[model samples]
Structures are given as C-alpha cells and as structure tokens.
Target: MRYRLSIEDMEPNHWVVWVLDLPACFSSAQTPVDAVALAPGRISAYYSWLSSHDSSLPVITESIEVEIVETFHSFASTQDQEYLVNAFFEDDRRPPNYWDVELALRLLQWTRQDLLKVVQSATQEQLSRPMVCEVRGSIAGIIKHIAGAENWYFDQLDLALDRAQLPDDPLDMLKAVRTNTRAQLVKLMGNERITKNCDELWSARKVIRRTLWHERDHTQHIAHLLAHL
Candidate 1:
C-alpha cells in the first residue's frame, strides 16, 4: 500500500518521519533515507497494534511520497511547513459505528503530539515569550488553553476527569491533560448511552468534531507563534 511520508530534519544527523494518513504514527532515523525506509515497517506495526485493539485493519496504499524539509530552527515554528501532516479521514469516508470514534481519538492523539513537536525544544524564555495573534497569549498560555478546552468538553459530557492544571513545566502539563482526557474518552466510547446522547451539547459526534477542531486550530496558532520567535 502507498502512503505519504513527511520528513523533517531535526538535527545535524537526525531526522523524523511522519506517516501522514496514520495519525500519531511516526519514526526517526539518523538519515533521511533510513527514515524513509523505516516508515513502511512502522506503518505495518501501527496497523498491527490497531488490529489488536479494535479488530480492524487500515487500507494500505501502494506507494509512498517522501517529501523532505530543512531542519527547523531550534525554536522555530512550523507555520511554513508545506506538508499537510495533520490531515484526518473525512467524515464521508469514515466507517460506520464506533470506528469513527476510534479514528477521532487517533487524530486527537496526533494533534497533541504535533503540538509537542513544535514546543519540545523551546527554552523557558521562548515558551514565555509574548505572541501577537488572534489568540493573544504566551506559548505556555496557549498550550494550557488547548488542554483546558479539552477538559471543558469532557466536563460537558459529565465525564469525571479533573480539570487541567498548568504545571511549572508547560509540556508536562500537556502530557498530563492529554493522558487524562484520552482515558476519559475511552470510557465514553464504551458507554453507548453516553456516546449516543441526544442532547446537542453532549452528543458523541459533536464532541468529537469540536475536540478535533479545537486541537487543530490551536496547533496552527502555536506553529505561527513559534515561527515569529
């Protein structure tokens, strides 16, 4: 099967590769060639893992398109990255039943990881630096906002997870919130009554759409902010 691989240089000899169609699935290698070569196996492994969890296999494409970009500045933003790395499966093409929920979860996971990649190398000063954007806030503030918003949606569904708390380290806070929110979502998926709630505010479809939109929206915000740093 064919897939699209977006390769980015991380350091002098390090590279990271993202399998575009498969959310949260990526691999790293010392060289671009090696990273490209490793992608198919990583993709296969991801499918294996997914099969174990949900008993479904993803459609594999026949060829892969490898697009490489230069190393980002240590604190640079991803605003200018040409590849559409976060593309999710469209609703029209989604499988019926809970499979779409699974896909949404995967997309959310990928969005969180993409956000982390943008800020992972930032120093404290960079993270705290002010940014001029529609969402006016520091990098850390934005991260907190993203995490907090997710928690709020969970709350709307009456999920009992705790609200997101900002920690001394912004990335740590992100990790905690993502873990907690994902756990709650897994629980939500298993509860049909909750998943199929008729109310507009807590319907499973609305929750999934909103969560994905919020995550993707702020992810772009962070990327644009970092680009100006």
Candidate 2:
C-alpha cells in the first residue's frame, strides 16, 4: 500500500517541514502556503502501510517535490505576505541527510531565478537612479553588493572571471550582475558539500540567506516608494 501525507497550516510558520518516520526524511521551506506545508512521516509508518499489500508506497529519494503556488497577489498588503504550496510524496524513503544536496541545489536555483527576475523588471532609469541611501538606491546597491560578494567568493576559489566589473550602463550592469552571479552559483554547486555541522556551511548559507533577506527588506521599501509615486 502507498500512503501519502499532506499537511497544511497557516499559523506558526506557513513553511512546512515534512519528514518520513524513518530516521530523517523531510524538507522544510518558508515559501508558499496551503496543502503542501506538511512534514515527512516516519519510514515505519510506510512499511506498515505497505504491508497491507493494497497499495505501493513511493521510494523517498534525495529530492521531495515541493510546489510554491502564489496564493495571494504579488503586490498584496504588506500585512498579508504569507503564501503556501502543495507537497506530493510517494512510497519511497531517503537516507538521512540525503536532503542536504537537494536543498542546496534547489535554493541556488531559486535565488538565481529571483535575482534575474528583479534585474529584468527594472528599467534603465530605475537602475541609474542616484545612489542616495533611499529605497531606490538602496535596492540597487543591494543587488550590486550581492554581485560583488559573489565575485569575492569566486576570486577566493580562483575561479575565472568573465567580467572584471559591472558595466557602467545601468541596464548593462543589471545584466552583468545576473550573469556573473549565476556563474558563481554554478561553480559553488560543483564544490563538495558543506557539512551542516561544520562552520564552513555558514559562509555559503549566509550568502544565500542574505540574498533572501535583502530581497524581502527591499520589497517592502519598493512598495512604500510605489505608494508615494
């Protein structure tokens, strides 16, 4: 028998963390809202359920399929920024820590897409906005800073650079930053896994986490600017 568990919650972290009853077979995300927010169940549960011989359980592998459905409007009120996605599980189980690589790779892809989207959304005038510590300048600067930080990592890794500096043109700079950041992420993906228990994981994780925080912080600022405009 194949048993699938789907849990959803709107309170105390809309991001669901699911796992199998087996030692550890789960994933969590702070994105999305809805039916996909449940944690994984234990393996023993699956075995027992499968013993019924009525259904076939999925083999949980390294990757759990998570969907981020935008339930609310992108420009919804700041007070209502919560969203959810659906989670689908099969009759399979993954080894403990199998999710490490999957999680890292998924996050890298999401961040790359996010950075590209943001840059592409802005106009040349917006990008060229004076660097006033204001929201406009601050957001622009944050993007530039992320690109610069990635460059630092690449240099430390002795990775080859396709570009020495961001283009002086506003639009070109945005394009360059997106291209360069993607390249850095691609290189980082090839490196050995950073142990979760090790301090080194912080360096890479921090960069990615900061990317998220930076976006959220500026997202609100942009909304405020839009209000006044």
The prediction achieving the highest TM-score against the true structure is: 1
Residue range with the least summed lDDT across 10 consecutive positions in model 1: 83-92
For candidate 1, what is the total of clashing residue pairs?
5
lDDT of 2 by residue, 1-229 (tens): 2333333232345443332222122233455333244432333433343333324544444433343322321222233344221222231112213353345345445445545566566665564566555643644665565555555444434542555555655335545655655555544533443321111222333333333334333444544543443
Top lDDT model? 1
Which stretch of 10 consecutive residues in model 2 shows the poorest summed lDDT?
87-96
Q: What is the C-alpha RMSD of each candidate to the true structure, in Å?
A: 12.3, 14.0
Off by over 4 Å in 1: 1-96, 132-136, 164-168, 190-200
Give each model a TM-score: 0.51, 0.37
- Give the Cα error of residue 88 in candidate 2, in Å: 34
- Expressed as tens digits, the lDDT of each residue in 1-229 for candidate 1 is 5666666564457666766555546666888788778877777766665655456655444554444432322222245343222222222122224665578777676676667778776778988877666364788888877777776666756763565344546567667767766776666554434332221214444455556657765776778877877
The global C-alpha lDDT for each of the candidates, from Candidate 1 onward, is 0.60, 0.41
